[model samples]
Target: MAVSRHLLFAILLPMAAVAADFPPPLLIAHATVIDASGAAPLGDADVLLRDGRIVSVGKALVAPPDTQRIEARGRYLIPGLWDMHVHLLRKGRPEAYFPLLIANGVVGFRDMGGDLGFDEIARLRREIADGSRLGPRFIAPGPLLDGPYPTLPSITRVLRNADDAAQAVLDLQRAGADFLKVYNRLPRDAYFALAATARAHHITFAGHVPLAVSAREASQAGQKSIEHLFNVLFACSSQEDALMREKARALDSTDVDERRQLRAHYLQAVLDSYDPARAQALFALFACNATWQTPTLVQRRAYAFPEQAAPDAALLRYVPHDQRWRFDPGQDARLQGRDAARQTLERRYFDMDRGQIALMRKAGVRFLAGSDAPDGEAVPGFSLHDELAELVAAGLTPMEALQSATRNAGDYFGLGDTGVIAPGARADLVLLDADPRADIRNTRRIDAVILDGRLLQRAALQALLDQAAEAAAGP
Candidate 1:
């Protein structure tokens, strides 16, 4: 899987695509358009795109003289999907994965955390932004802002106090970060200072609600989004204060036996303290504050059931054979080690996350669909489909699930010109072989992808996948 850069470029840089300096006018005729705005799909729709923007969308449209026509008579069309969380770090071979995003119709994604010194990451981001690169749009916080003693020292900016936190925010923004990503274990004072500094700089701060800050307080204080249901679960329980104190004490311990016992007690207390009323209040606060949620349910599944991470032939084709075997020791090695207690806790957390998601929706809390792609367990592109299915399983309708990856995603990132398929929106769309309304998994049946008006027909898309697989299975 150690591919030479020259070889990788040869395979991935499609000559035709690179040669097309200007996008052609394309007309997709007789397709079903699912706009993902809760409206019914329009049958036999004719869509027109010229120069990376949708020019016409209706029941009948005569193609322009220079238009390239595609007969999509029986196809279903939807706005392109977005993965709200991803990490295309250099170590992950981001170059090999961009095609996967286009192959799966993921046109936008967020790289939540990675090494700040990973120069290739920002270069790729710039390339995409400047339209020289073709793939998902990238939003990232260069590195994670963590407490004094960071777990991942190399990728972390250790902040000892509020002054350090404020300075870190300024430095990160100056370094080209789209937003600020705060990590767990950040001191209460430092986290708040980071938040305030980010606000002053007109940048949004999103990520884990530090363990020191309750979810309600985080929402009230303007934490933009909470990742992985981290603080929400504990903060919503009736035993919030007690559970938090116990969790804090347990986490601070060094002795193995004592920490294990305390963790067990804390988990049990969390399981028993489900409070619908408290959860309702918390969700209300989130809605009012416009705080978003990226549950990353796919990650939850990988943690709760590590056996599923076993890559089959199809999966291995996209991920390096060596990289496929390196994810078991992430969380105390609980997954690979198969610790029964950790499995039980992970499952509970997963189920609890589902419940919270249902309640959050009921309380009108907006959400975004994220796969945490290439994050050890989840596969890129494909995991977004899995996340949509998980959302439906968690009580969101197929439409609601789709919206999380579409409109909600666009709104979260303040990209108003995209997300919809109407005239004037960015012409990023997916042509499906089947109606996704019947089954969320139908989203995976991609027939074609319209990426920035560059039509990737089924055959071209397949070529992209094949190239990714070959790059992964290097000679």
Candidate 2:
């Protein structure tokens, strides 16, 4: 299903959408607006939406004679959230999770590498655009490109040399992938070749900094966004050159026991060798290049302390039987047969990860909120809110945390009108019972969600949750 870039664009024109079947003009009156444009919240304002785009926002606005309106006094309005990293195809239950995501106000996302092919994802995208589906708008990397010895073979395409890597960039682009997802184990030559090919083709490449490449090298090569802090901690170590040589071997080895021992050794080494000066320089380089980071602290914490990662009883009901094993601590590979010393070291690594945020922010490095949801203990829609909480705990102001999922996402995607509340912007918004700027956790107190100008009130949102629960419970 290889499509030329021109044909792909023609077919995907619906993606730049105003909902095809939305009702007449809708008015939301007396609501306080948190526009996510770094502006002060507007008090007691009125917002008008027509044809799936915001038509006006002011202190008071009148609507058409036949307009539908929501009296939103005492509520706060904000842009709908985006989970920057997700894997919708891994478990293959998008039918169930789509409702859950919308219920939690996730209007958009970026799918990292997954099992679904590009053609199928494009079909889903079309359905969502035409108002035939109930899910977030997304940009996806159909399958990730990895090294000769591919990791996660089910979702990876192996590139053994520079030629293969370069060709893959062209091939994935023809297949209509939004961007190239580069993974670990890539040889240095292949990684750079992929980057060069992607640049020539006008497609961006993002994801892991391969074992053979430094974060600085990846940034220089124009990797757009780095996910999960892979390679970053090691790159910030004073002993980076020596440690990386050892770390690369650890990852490339086929022997599990040998690999685990090597990983344990380097984990402690990275912790002990962290150099703030080195990190400052690295962060400065990242800022200079405008590279974004999706640290995904929620999943990292789950991996660090699996015993405490279990979801609460309420959330557990949403975990399907086939997927529940992933939530179990016993299934955590990091915890299996590890000694007390390794466990303590892992905790310290997580704390160090949290500490990196403050320094990186100070050095002008920007972030995007991602939960790596349904990976480890990250639950589908709910885990995004958890990621925000983790970001605030890690030193982001509530506004900064909100921007990671809203304004920053729009900037990253180059969609100027998607993540803000203003005239001509997409009518995707969230209404909260409390002001999220006052306390980040108030984001969870959602009163309603408006997607493409069609409002879903509190009862409607609850029905979506109930529908998801029923699907999860079914055979």
Candidate 3:
């Protein structure tokens, strides 16, 4: 079957002046094309791009005189990757952050949530579209719309009641948000109010499954996507109903320590009582409601095995000095003077995360690969590659993992213009030094990155990284 007719947000990723320039066709000749649309690899094929769209993909297609040829006799060609769930800036400048994406062959990304003001977010996106910034195509929620009690009050828009919830949705959408991001503490009634209002405005509402609501109810209420697999894991556990009851009571507690103890106890209960049959039922509902899951298993694993995360000197160059703690294993609370009990819980959650992916696959529920980076103290550009590898480790085939980053995300967010290499798709392509199908890690071997029909040659791509490193080195 062909790709869906999902119309991308037009202004969401408007190409630069390269679109009007009608740059000469970029001929990637003699490459093995793994389109990521489940089509068999086209051995020794030529993929042509012109005017910001893929014009053709075939064997030995005629190379016009006006074309710039990339001799790819043994290389692999695929759609540029998308990081579906990311927090773009938890530490450094957006300037220092963007080039790392292109340098790593990530041409598109969804800013799951950020602290940037609405206009600032709009400005950054506009810069990318106008070719003024060397960043990936950005689509983000204006700011987080959280419950009255929020963890990050600076970036959060507090919704104290159902009326506040409804107004918050309208206000954020009007302020040029790509979607409404409902946060964890939102009451069930307020969460529904926001969802209903988002539906009325024809906007996408996504984020956490509120504390009082089950994943099934969120899916039923038109929650477009759920990030971090937040409450879904427990929602599928055998103790789901009981856990929900407990959570409702926990919210009323003024004692912070008491709440934490109760949370830890009940979470342990969830892992012990996990039921595959119940999981299958939740998966069925998720599939039925067309709600997508962005499983940021990387975050979960980082907490579970913080000792394994040694900072890389090379990758840290792109990470600002103050922001480097994000990559520090010592910073994770789960690892700081760990007890055997907490370790077991972390390990169980990590295993359950993989189990959830396998079950989601069996139930035919779609997934979007998200790094949940920056939030995980992840080094932005490199963390996405790690996320892909983690997806494969969890149970996805290389192509399946690639799809979660590409086609599945495109389908999820209606960024149909990108995430595929085909006639009329966006001309964002990545040429790898080796076939990623053979090993998903080969995706990291980017030989060249094509963005908006403009080629960034290997040397040019290296320069982007170098410049980012220099900027990040700033005091």
List the candidate 1 regions with Cα displacement exceeding 4 Å.
Answer: 1-20, 116-119, 126-133, 254-258, 327-332, 336-342
Which regions of candidate 3 deviate over 4 angstroms?
1-13, 16-18, 89-91, 245-260
What lDDT does candidate 1 reach at residue 202?
Answer: 74
Per residue, candidate 3 scores C-alpha lDDT tens digits across 1-475 of 1211111443334664335655688998999988898889989999988888898888878867899998999999888888888888433568677888888888878787777776676677667767677778767776687777785778788888899989887777666677778887787778888888878777887888878789889999989888888888788777888887787667667876667677678778788888878888899988888888888877777777777665568778887777777688776543565577877777886787677888887778788878876767566677788989988888888999999887876787655666898898888889999888889999999999998888998899999999899888985
Q: Which should have the higher lDDT, number 2 or number 3? A: 2
Best by TM-score: 2
Model 3 residue 265 lDDT score: 81
Question: Tens digit of lDDT per residue, candidate 1, span 1-475?
Answer: 1222322232223322344454779999999999988988899999999877799999789877999988999889999998988876646466578889889999878788876453665566556645666667666677888897776678888998999999998787666666778887789999889888877777788888777889888888788889888868888788898888787777677777777677767777787887878888889999999989998888877766777754466776798766766544354344444367777886786788678898889889988999887774777888899999988998889999999999887677665655788998878899999989899999999999988788998899998888788877867
Ranking by lDDT: 2, 1, 3
Q: What TM-score does candidate 2 get on C-alpha atoms?
A: 0.96
Give the CA lDDT, 0 to 100, for residue 247 in model 3: 70
lDDT of all predictions: 0.79, 0.86, 0.79
